[model samples]
Target: MTTPARLSAPAVATPVPWPDDSVSVLRNRPVRLGTDPASLSRFGDDDWNIRPAHRDAHTTICNLNLRVFPEPLRRQFRAVLLAALDHPQPVEPGGRQRSAEYIGIGSMPVLARGLQLFAHWMHLQGVRQIADITDHDLDVYLQHITGTTTPLRQQANTLNSVRTLWLFRDVLPASCRLAAQFPWPGRTANELVGLRTSNGENKRPRIQDDTMEALLAWSLHMVEEIGPDIRDAWQEYTLLCRGEHSSQAIYVGTAGPRLRAYVDQCRRTCTPLPGIPGPDGPRINYGHVLRLIGLDGKGAFSPAQKRWLAGQGLPVAEHSTVGVITGQIQGRPWRDTPLAIGELSGLWRRLAGALFTVVCYLSGMRPGEVLSLRRGCCDTDEATGQLVMHGHRGKGYDRAPDTPDAAEPTRPWVVVGVVHEAIALLESLHDQPHLFPAQLRVGMFRPSATHARTCSSVNRDIADFAAWVNQTFRRADGSAPIPDDPAGNLNASRFRRTLARFIVRRPRGLIAAALQYGHVDTKVTLNYAGAPDTEWLQDVAVEKLELVLEQISDDAQRLAAGEHVSGPSADEYRRRVVGSADFPGRTVISPRSAERLLGSTDPQVHHGEGMTCVWRPETAACRAARLAQGLPEPAGPDERECRSTCTNLAFTDRDITRRKQDLHDLKATASDPLAPRPLRDRAAAQAERIASLVHRHEQHRNEGAPA
Candidate 1:
C-alpha cells in the first residue's frame, strides 16, 4: 500500500501519431468518454496494429479520445486498452487448431468504460500517473464501484478487471514504472477475498405431482387415440406411392360378396360410389362408373348416375382420374389427396408433441438431450422388460475425447413404462433417422432430418398441448375441469426437476432408490445401465436432506418457545437440536456430515420410511427393530415397523397432515358394517393414536398462539 506523489499538468507534451481515418470513425457518433474531447488529440499512434475498422473497437477508440491525459500517461493507457482487446484463448485443446482470431470482439467497450471511470476518479484526486496511486486510493475506487446493492460477484468482476491496469507498468516511463505497485495481488474472481457470499442455491420451480399426473393422463389418452390412425395413414401412403393400386382397392373373403353386390348395384342402377366428392356438383357420371368397372372407354357418368350418386350424398365428376375411388380404397395411396393429407399431418404433429411430453417428463432428460435422441435410441431390456433410452450429453461436449474425429459420447436413461409406450408409438409413425422429423405444413412425408426441432420448439409444443387439454377435456362428472398451473408457465427443463423431486420422495426399495444417477461412461454401463448426464440428482438429494434438517431445527425451536409438538419423538427431538449447545439458529448440515453423525449420540435423530426417529438406544420403543437387536444402537426402526407405538418418531406439518388423512381413512374403515370385528377394532385403535397426536399438537400450537 505504498503512496505515490501527486501529479500536475506536465511541462512539455509529446505528439501522438494516429491514423488519418480515425477521426471519421467517431465524428458523427455521440459516444460518451467521461472527459474533455480536446485532450484526445495528444497521444494516439499509427503504430497500434489493432483493428480500427470494427464497430466495438472503433467506438472504444473514439471514447478513448475524450480521456484527456498527459502524453506518457495516455501511452500506458493505450497499451493496456490494446492488450485487453485481444481475443480470449481457446478453452478446449481439441478445438484450438480450428480456432481463428476474431476482429472487433472481446469486451472492448466494457474495458474502455472502466478505464474512463478510473480516469475520472484519478482526475478528481489529482493522480496523473500509475505511480501516483496508493492502496488507500485503490480502496476508495473499489468502494465507489461497489454500491450498497451491488452483488458481491459483480463487484469482484469489476475489481478483477481493474487489476489488468497493472499491466500498464510495461509501457510506463522508467521512473513511473519503478514507483508503480498494484494495491491487491492478482487472483481469480473466485479466489479473491470479499467475493464470497452466503447466497443460497437457486431453486427452480417443479410441477406438482397432481398437475403432472393430469398432464400425463391427457397425453396418454391422446396418444392412444391418434397413434394408430397416424401409423395406418403412413402405411397406406407408402403402399400407394409404390403403386400397389389393385391390392389397395379391395379386401378379400366375406367382403368379396359385399363388394360384388355394390358393383352389381352400381352397374344395374348406373350410380356412383358413396363418400366421393365430384367436380362441380354432388352427383356422379354413369360413363365414369362404367369405365371404373371396365365398361366404358370414355369414362363418362350419365345424368341418371349423377342423380343417384347425388341422392347418396356423393359428389359427381365428369371424368375418371387418380383421386376417384370406385371401390373400398382403405390401402390406397392417399398422400396426394388433400383431405387425407391434412387429417394425417395434423394427427402426426399431435402424436409427436404428446410423445415428446411423455418422453421428456418420464425419463427426466433435459430438453437438449431429448431433442438429440435418434429414431432407434429407445429399446427394451430383454431380461428385465424395462425401457432404456440412449442419448448423448449436449452441454458438456468438452468432456468428449480429444481426437481428430472423436464421436460424441453417449449415455443411457432408465425410463418408465409409459415412456416406452410413447417411444413405440413414435417409431410406428414412420421410419426416419430422427424420432421427431421436420415436416412441412401440408405434406404427409417428412422433409429432412438435418435440422431437428430445438428446445424452444419443444417448450412451445408442451405449452400448446397443455392449452389444448385445458380447452378440449372435461371431468367424467363434469364438476371441475383440469386447471392450468396458476403460474401459467410449463417449461421443458422444469420436467427434470419435477421428476427428481418425485424420485426423491418415493418409498424405500422403489425404482428411484434402485436406480443409480450421475454421468455414465464405459461401453458396458452405457449399453446396459443408464448413466445420467449430470450429478444434479445427487445435488438435489443433498439439498432436500438439508431442508429436512432445517425443518427439524425449526420445529425444535418452536417447541422450545412453548409451541406444542405431539409426535412420539417430539420431546427427544427438541432435546437433541434445540437444547444442544452446538445446535443454534438456521444452520445447514452437509449430507455427508449428517450421515456420519446420525444415531451417534443419545436422543439421536434417525431417518425412516414414514417419520424421523429421536430415541435413546436402550429405551427404543420400535418393537420390530428392538426385538431383533435388543439394543438401542443396532435396533433402528425397520421400514415396516409400527409408526404409532414408536416413541422415537417425529412429525412435521406435512407429516401431521398425513396423520390426519390416515385418521380419516381409518375411521371410515372402522365404521363400515362389512368390516370384520378384529379389523374394525384395529382401525379404531390406529385412528385413536393419530387423533391423540393431532390433538396434542394442536393444543400446544394454540397455547403458543400470539394473542
Candidate 2:
C-alpha cells in the first residue's frame, strides 16, 4: 500500500459553546449479574438477565458459585444428580429443563432450586416456552436455598438476589452437552442450604448465655485455684465467650486447645441437631472446635480431629512460674499468621501505608521500589522525589533476543512508603550497600513454605517490632498484645499491597500514585494491587488482559519457582524486578478482555500491526456471480498453513519491486536513533512481546490470545 500524501488542511470551523457537563460518558459500563429472569432457549445480552448471543455473559454466571466454594458443592451436587436420574421435564419445551430431576424436592431442595434456576435461565436464553410452572412455583424454588426472607436477611437485598441467581446459574454445565450435567458449585451450596430448609430450625446446639457464663465463672475459679499459665488460658476462653478481640490470645497456641476442650465438654451436655444426637448427651464435630480456633474449612464444619473431644474436660488452670503460653492458642488466626506487612500496614496505618502496599503488591518489585526509590517514574520534574515503584523492564532493544518468549506478566507486588521509614531506619541500621538489602538475604535460605525468602524476612522483622511494641506497652488491664515482638512488620514486599490498598481507598491521590502507576481506574488498580479475581472475568473480550495481575501475584513464588532453572539465585529476582512491564491500557482493558482481542503471537503468520495479506482474483468464489459468474473456492486450508497462496492472483513487477524495496527500507528505518520515540518504542515492544508469546507457548503449550 502506498503511503497517502499529506496535503492541505481545511479552514477552521466556528467553535460552539460547550455544555455544562462536558464529560460525556462512554458506552463501557460493565454488565451487572442478577437473577430477575432466566432463559429457556439460551441467555441473551440483556443487562438484567442472561444473554444468548454472548457466551461470555452466559458462562460469566455459570460455574461462578463453582469458583466460590468448589469441592463441597460438587460433592453435594453429584449425589442429588445421581438420585434424580429418572425425573424428567419436557426436553423439547422451548429447549428448557436441562432436566426436571434437577428440580426434585426430595431430600435435597438446593439441587431442586438449581434445576429451577437452570430452567429459568434457559427461558432467559430466548426460547419463549409455555409455562410448565407459574411464577409462584419460581418463588417456592427461590425460598429453597437462601433461608426464607427473614427481615434481617431481607436487608441484604443484593446478596439475596445474587443468592437466587447463583442457583439459576448452577445448572449450566461446566462443559456439558446436556445441561443437567452442569458442574456448577451452586449445586453443592444449594445442598448445604438444603439443611436449613428440611429442619426448619437451627439444628446445631449452641451454648446459651447463662450456660456460657457458668462455664466462664467455673473456668476462672479453676484457674485461680490452679496455675498462672492455665489461668491465662481460662481468661482467653472467657474472652472468646464474651466475643472480645481476644484474637490476641491466639499468640499462645495452647489456649485454643485448652478452651476447645472445655467447650467440647459443655457441648456433650446440650441438645443436638434432630436425628443426629450428641455423642453422650451432645456430641460436637470437628467443625465447631475449629471455628473456636478461627480455622474455617470449605463449607463443612467439625471440631477437627476424627472424634469429638471425648468425655473428659480440661483440668483447672495451674500456675506456672515461667508465664509462657504455647501450642494451640499461640497459633490461632493462622490466616493472619505471618501477618503480611502489606496487610498490617494497610489496616492499622490509617490506610496510608496501603498505597505503598499497592505498588509492591502489584509489581513485586525488589526493596528498591520502596527503600531505594527515587521520584523518576511518577515525576518528570522531581528527579529525587518520592518513588512510585512503577518498574517494568521493557523488551529487548535492537535485535530481538533468541531466547524463549516470556509472556507479558502483570505486577503482583508494588510498594511505596512502608519502606520509607524502613529506608530511613536502614540508613541508621546498616551502611549503604543497596540499603535494607533483603535480596542479599534471599540467597541464604532454601525456599520454604514457612518463610518466603524475599518478602517474609522483612515482614518477620516488622512483626517482631510490632509484637515488641504491644508487649512493652501493656493495656490498662495489664495484658500484653502483639506489635510487641520487637520484629516490626515492615519488609521487602511491603511496597506493593500497601500501595494498592491505598490506591483503592484513596484513588484521588492517583495522579500522585500514578507518579508510580499512572492514572488508571481504581477497579483495575485494585486487581493490580492483588484484590481477588471475583469480578471482571466474563467481561468484553477487550478487558480480559487485566487478569495478568492476578496470575502473577497469585503465584509469584510458584511462577518464580517453576521458572527457576536452578535454585533461584539473587540475580534472577533482580531481573524479574527490572524486566517486568506494567500492562498498558489497564483502565479500559481487563485480563479476559485482553486475551480475546490479542491472539497469541506466532511467527507462522505476520501479526500485530505489521500483518499483510493479498486477495486472489482467480479464485472461483471471487469470480462468482459476475451476473451468475463462475466462482472458485478460496484455495484451501492447506494454503493457510503458509504456502504460495498469493500466486492465485497475478503479481505485477512493480508489486514485487515495491515489496522488496519496502522490506529494505523498513530494515534500515528500524535502526534510526532519531526516529519518533513511540515508533522505536513500539517496535521494541512488539519484539519483546513476540519473545514473551513464544516463551508462553513453550511453557503453557496452550497460549491463547494476549488475554
Candidate 3:
C-alpha cells in the first residue's frame, strides 16, 4: 500500500504540526524514520475528524514518533494507535450532563511502550514484517510478561496492555491480524492473570467495636462544645466582611490612648483607617482581637467578663498582655478536656474536619461523594421526612464542558441525624457553600481545587483525630486512658465494608436490614463483604446446622459401641434422634440442597455461637417478643435469653461433652466429706437436671425427625 496524504483536519485546530521536534529528535536513535509509504492506508483514506478530547491523544502520537518503525510496520502501528485514540471510553451516563468519555491521557504512554515491547520481541525472534507475526508470537509475548519471577500484578498489567493494542486486529494487515485460535482467552484481566484472591477486597481492616465506641464518645463531646455558638459567630463575621465597614478591630498596645483619640477624630470627619484590610485579605488579626474580647477559646463568658472570669478561679497575671484572665498558664500538662485554643480561628477549621469524620463514618458515603458536597446540600425529604445529602458523583463523570448535560450533577443520599447536624455546623462556619472548606489563605476558607481537600486530607485528619483522642481522653473514674487500636489502620474506604460485616453478623440481619445502608441489593452486599455470593451467607448458616447434627451422630455412634454415658438425656438422645431413621448425614452439604436437607418437622436448627436452638415456635418457652407486641411471626427463643430449663434448647456434641464433665464434678462435690447437707442436695439436684436436659434434647430431636 502507498502512503496517503496528511490526515484530515481534526474537530479542533492546533497551530503546532505533527512530527515536530520530537520526531526529528528520534532520528538520532538506533532507528530512523522510514521513507513515507502509507501510514494511513490501513485506516481509511478519509479525513480524520478528531474530537476536541482526542487532541491530547494526537499530541501523544506525534511525540511518540510513529515514523521510527519500518515502512509497513509503521503503517500498521499508526492505524492501530490512531484507532484506539479515536474511540473514547464513555462514562456511565446519567444526570443532566452529557460527559465526554475518552481514553485517559496517562494510558497513551503505556500503549506506546507496549507497541515498542512487541516490536522488540518480534525483532529478537528474527521476524522482519508484521505479516509473519502469528498466534505463536503472541504466546511468546504473554510468556515474557509472565516471566518466571515477575510479580503477579505487574504481569497482569503487561498482559492487559498487549491485549488492548491487539484489539485493533481488524485494522492490521490481513496476515498479521490475530486468528480464532489466539493464545490468550478474551476473558477479564483477573481471569487471564489466574491469580487467586488478587482483588484485595478482604485486605481492608475493620475498626474494632470498642475503639469505634471510644472515638464516637470523644467526637460527640467535641461537637457539643463548639457546634452551636461558633456557627453564629462565623455567620456574623461573613456579614461584616460584605457590609461597608472596616471590620479590623484596632490593635492598641502602648499607642492605645493615641489610637482611641485618632479613631474619634476620624469618625467625626467620616474618614477611614489607612489601608483597611479587604475581605479577601483582611489586615486585621482577628485571633488577637478574639483574645482581647475574652472569647478566644470554646467556652462562654459573662457580660462583666473580667470580674466573672476572676471570680471563676481564673487568676489574672499582673503583667500579662492577653485580655482574658485565666489561671491557665502556657506551660502545663495537656489536660484531658476540650482543647484550649488561644486563637479561635483554628478551632472552627479543626471542628469542620472533626464533623467530616463523624459524617463519613455514620453515613457510609464514599470519600469522594462526601468531599464533593457543598453548602445547602443537606435537606429533609418532604415525603419521607428523611435527611438526604446532595452532591456530584465523583466516578463516571464526563470531562467535556460543552456536552448538553445537566449543569449540576446532584445526587441525594439518605443520612442519619449526626450527618445533618454536621452539615448545619459546616454551613455556619462559612458563607461560601462548601460543606468542608479549609483555610487556603487569610480570610479565604472557600472551595478550590487547591484548597478543597480530597480523601488523602480526610484520611490524615482522621488519623490525627485518633491520635488526639488517645492523648486527651481518659475514663470517667480516671482509672486508665483509652488505648489506641494496635494496628492504627483506620481509613475512610473501610467503613462501608466494616458496616456491612456488622449487619451480616447480627441476629436477623437479613437482606431487609442490608437495604438501609448502601442502596444495593443482597448480592451487592454479599460481594462487598467478600462472600462468594448471596447463597454464601445461607451456606454458612447451613454448615453450622450440619456441625450440630454431626456431633449428635458421633454421640450415638459412641453409645452404640457400648461406651459409658452419664448425661440425663444422653442415652435418650442417642436412641431417639441419633439412631432414628430421620438422622441427617455427617457429610458436607452445598447451599442448593440445604433447604431439602432439613424440613420444618425435622430438627429445628437455629445456630448461635457455641449453642443451637432446636426451637418449635408453637411451643416456644420464651415468648416475650411475640406475646407482648402482637407480631405476626412467632417469637423464637433468644439465644442469650435461653434458660437451661427451656424445652426448645438443644445442646451440641461439644456442649453435651461439657455437660458430662460438669455432672461428674457436681457428683464429686456431693460425695465430698467437706460438703454441707444443703450443698450436697443442691449439687445432686443439678446433676439430675443436666442429665434430664440432655435426654430431653434427644427426644425433641427425634420428635422433629421424620416419623
Candidate 4:
C-alpha cells in the first residue's frame, strides 16, 4: 500500500477573547471549587482542585496539572483545556454548531487527561507550538494510541480531544491555535479508531444464573437478617466511644455490683460467657462481659472478680473485645467469630455492597440513579399500596450554559417490597443524606465529606462482596456460597441486562424472577421497564426476539426428529421453521440484521405455556379484544388471551403430552365424590373437550404420516 500524504496546517484564524485564568470553568458549582477561582493561576499552579459540588465524593477532584507536560507545551495545553471548560459545545470549522448541552464540570478531568496525552506526544516530537504540528504527527499519535492495550473506547476519547483542539480553535489564543484541520475529515473519532457503532445491543455480559442466585440470596440474607445485628453493634460501639461510663469512681461504686449480679445470673442459668474464636480455641469475650454489666472500660474487672470467674470456668483475656453476633444463616450462626470493632467498617462496606446488588438487580435502576437515592426516596402509594422510588434521573438532562444548579428531575421507579427492605438497611448503615454514601464511616479523608458512592467503587464493592461471601459463608456441603461466573466480576451495569434476560426467559424456580416479577403484577413491571427514560423495554424486546428465533430453531429440530405438529397453523409453522434453517443460533447478529430477518420471515410465532402461537394478525381472535379495549394492534400474540379454538394455536408433541396429563387430572377431579357438584360438572366438561382435542391431534398426526 502507498503511504498517505502528511497532514499540513490550515490557515490561521483570528483569535477570540480569552477568559482570564482566574475564571472558573465550572459554571455555578462554586463551593466545590476548593479554592477561590480569582486566586487560581492556571499557568503558575500545578494542581487545581476543580471537582464539581454535584460530583460524588468517590470521584477524584479534577486537577489540571500542567507540570506533567513539557514546559514548552504547558501554555498550549492550558489553552486547549480552558477552551474546553469555557466553550464545551464549540463549533467545528465549516460545521454546524452542536445543539447538545454544554459539557458539565464532571467531564473536565476526562477532557484534561485526553489533552494531557496529546500534549505528551507533541512534547516527545519536539513540537512546541500547535501551529508546527503536522498531519503526519497526528496520524502517528493515533497509531501509537491504537497500538496500545488501552480499550477502544478510551482511545476514541483521546483522539476526540485532538479533534476538540481543532473544533475550539477559534476560542483559543492565536499562539495555541492549530494551523492544520483535523486530519481525518468527515470521520468520527470512533470510526477513525475502528470502534463499531452501537447497534442497540447491550454488550454487557449477563451474570450467570447460579452466581446471580447465590449473590442475591446472600445479599437478602445480609439486608434482612444480619443488618439488624450490625446496626445494634454499631449503636453499642458508638455508645462506648462517648466515654459516659468510663469513670473509675462509677465502676467502683455501681459497676462492681452489676458485674457480680451478671456473673451470678449466668452461672445460675448455666449460660456460657460469650466467646470469640482464639488461637487455642474459643475464649471469653471481655467486651460483651463489660457491656452486660454496664461497665465501659476494658480491664475494669477487679482481681477478686477475675478469680471468682476463673473458679466458675470463665476467664477474661487481656485484649479480647468481640462484640455480639446474633445473625444466622441456614439455622447456624452466620459468623463463627464475634465482630470486632475494627472489622465493622469492612463489614459495613460488604453489607452496603449486598444492598447495592439487591437494589440494582431488583429495581432495574441505573447505578448512578441508585447512588443518588436519598433517605425517604422510597414510599408506598397509599391508594395502590405499590412501592415506588423517587430519585434523580442521572442521564439525559438539558442544562443551560450559565445555570449552575441545573438539578436532575425526580423520576419514579416501581420496585418490589424487597427493595424497600434494602433501602431500609441502607438508611440504617450511615447518616449521609444519600442512601449509598461514599464512606460508611469517617476515615482518613475528610470527616465531613458527604457525597454519593462512585460507580467504580460500587463495582469494587460487588467484587469484594462475592469474594467475602465465598470466604465467609458456605453451603450445606461446605462449598463456597457464591460461585465464580465465567462472565467475570459482577458490576452495576450488568444487572439490568440480567433482569431483562430473567423477565424474558422466565426460568423455572428462579428466586430472583419470583422476587422481581411475582410480587408485582405485569402492569407494575411494565411501568418500570417501559418508562421512556430506560432502555430496559428495548432490552426485553431484543431478548424476546432472540428467544423467538431460538424457539423456531428448536421446533425445526423437533420436526426433523419425526415429532408431529398439529394445529390450524401447523403447515405454516413447519414452512416458516424449515425456511429458517439458516438461522444462526447464539451467534452474534447485528440488530439491523435481526430486524431484517424478522421482517422477511414474518413468522409472528410466540411460545406459550401449552401451545405455540403462529399468529396471523388479520385473523387473530385477540385482535377483536385489543380493538375493543382501545389498544393498538399488537405486533405479536397476546398470550393472556390465547384461546384453545383460535386458529393461531399450533400444538407440538410436548403440548399434546401436557394436554393429555391435564385431561387425566381433569377426569380424576370429575370422578371425585368429595368435590362440589358444580366443580365436578365443570371438570367433566373440560376433560371431554381436551379428550376431543387430543383425539383430533392424534388422528391428524397419523393421517399426515406415510400413506
CA-lDDT, candidates in order: 0.52, 0.31, 0.48, 0.69
Check candidate 4 and list the clashing pairs.
7-135, 9-180, 10-179, 10-180
Best by TM-score: 4
Q: For candidate 3, lDDT tens digit of each residue in 265-312?
A: 545766433221355532323332333432344233334542432233
Output the lDDT of residue 344, model 3: 38
Q: Say which prediction, candidate 1 or candidate 2, comes out ahead on lDDT.
A: 1
Q: Compared with the true structure, what per-residue lDDT tens digits does model 2 show for residues 1-707?
A: 46223222222234322212222111111111221122211111111111211111101122112222233233232322322322332232124336432222121233433443444443454323312333433344445435545343232332233333323322323321122212122333334344323422112222232322232232232222222333344334334434453443443345346445545544665522111133344333344344344443424433453333443442221111111333132233212122211233222221112223333334444333343232233321154343333322221111111112322232222234433332333233222232333231224322121111133444454344334434434445776533221233344332333334343223222112222223333334442233433222222112212233433243244434443211112233223322332323233334343444333311111111121122223432223323243332322112222222233222222223444454455545456789987777666654554444334334442332211
Q: Considering summed lDDT, which 10 consecutive residues are worst modelled in model 2?
A: 601-610
Candidate 1: list runs displaced more than 4 Å.
1-204, 208-211, 224-226, 233-247, 250-341, 379-386, 399-409, 440-451, 476-482, 486-488, 504-532, 538-568, 576-612, 615-647, 650-707
For each predicted model, how many residue pairs clash, with residues at least 3 apart or on different chains? 13, 159, 13, 4
Cα RMSD to the true fold for all candidates: 15.3, 30.3, 15.0, 6.0
Candidates sorted by lDDT, best first = 4, 1, 3, 2
What TM-score, to 2 decimals, does candidate 1 have? 0.50
Task: Report the lDDT of model 1 for residue 706.
Answer: 22
Best by lDDT: 4
Residues 176-229 of candidate 4 have per-residue lDDT tens digits of 777775656666679877899776666889888898888999999988788778
Error at 571, model 2, angstroms = 60
What is the Å distance of residue 626 in model 4 from its true position?
Answer: 5.6
Scanning candidate 3 in windows of ten residues, the lowest lDDT window is 26-35
Decoy 3 TM-score against native: 0.49
